[model samples]
Target: MDGITGETDSLGVHLHYDLGNGDRLQLLRLATVAPDQPLAALVPLDGDGLDRLEAIDRLLRTLLGRKIPQDTRLTPQQRRRSRHMLQAIDGRMNGASYRDIATALFGADRVNDHPWKTSPLRDITMDLVKDAFAMIAGGYRTLLRRRHRGS
Candidate 1:
């Protein structure tokens, strides 16, 4: 499994790899500009999976309101491992620097220095991953509840 890192405006979100199926573990944000935002959420599909990656690409482009550079395809591996989004947000919010917060949350040795490009597209992609999982999880949980009640 790949040790993955992604960030949204310096909020310090990360995605680790899962050994079993190579799925991205989830994005975890240690802090945020607003108190209401969640700390973490899972992406439903593997970060390297074709459908999910394409979806993410489209999502980022739309959110940024600009076309991805013609040569840029935005492969999942790229998004799965990026930490720029989190750092950028931190920069905007005047919060603790990314290095400090990331070190605190993920340990000093583990934090990498790769930069992530932040835009509306990146934000949307992060959100979509969470939403996709919630919708599915909610359906299954509801079904389980109904089944237990019926029994």
Candidate 2:
């Protein structure tokens, strides 16, 4: 027999199952559990045998398919920020000036300040643009490879 424990938090659900024979499984940020799904079917109530192993395999597949919730993965504000950064990077690639990108994103008054090079807002914007460009170049590919390796 296996004992199951679960809890929910801001990220999502965390689950741990201990199979009596020393095998254990831990799952984090499981998006959701369908109310009508036969969760109990994955646990053998009678005996621990080949049937339980098969059940575990099926459960793993089903849970992996669900994926982590979007909010748990990235907040709405973060998503918007990333989108803006990508737009700024695209504008730069198209030969738009930093001031022009700033004006388009934050308005003329915010970007028209003298000594723009020393401006905090301008510096932050430039940093974001640089990061976006790096991501487009090779950082994104590295991230994807890391994700696959981790999985």
User: Please, what is the TM-score per model?
Assistant: 0.20, 0.45
Candidate 1 lDDT over 51-149, as tens digits, reads: 455545654554346675442344455444334334443443466554544454455555543332443343444454444445445533332111121
Whose lDDT is greatest here?
2
Candidate 1 minimal-lDDT segment of 10 residues: 142-151
Candidate lDDT scores, in order, read 0.44, 0.65
Question: What pairs collide in candidate 2?
Answer: none
**lDDT tens readout by residue for model 2, 36-145:** 44343345465343445554555655455544322233457756777878889988989998878888888888777756887776886797799898888777643321
Q: In model 2, where do residues sit more than 4 Å from their true spots?
A: 1-70, 141-151
What's the distance in Å from true for residue 43, model 1? 32
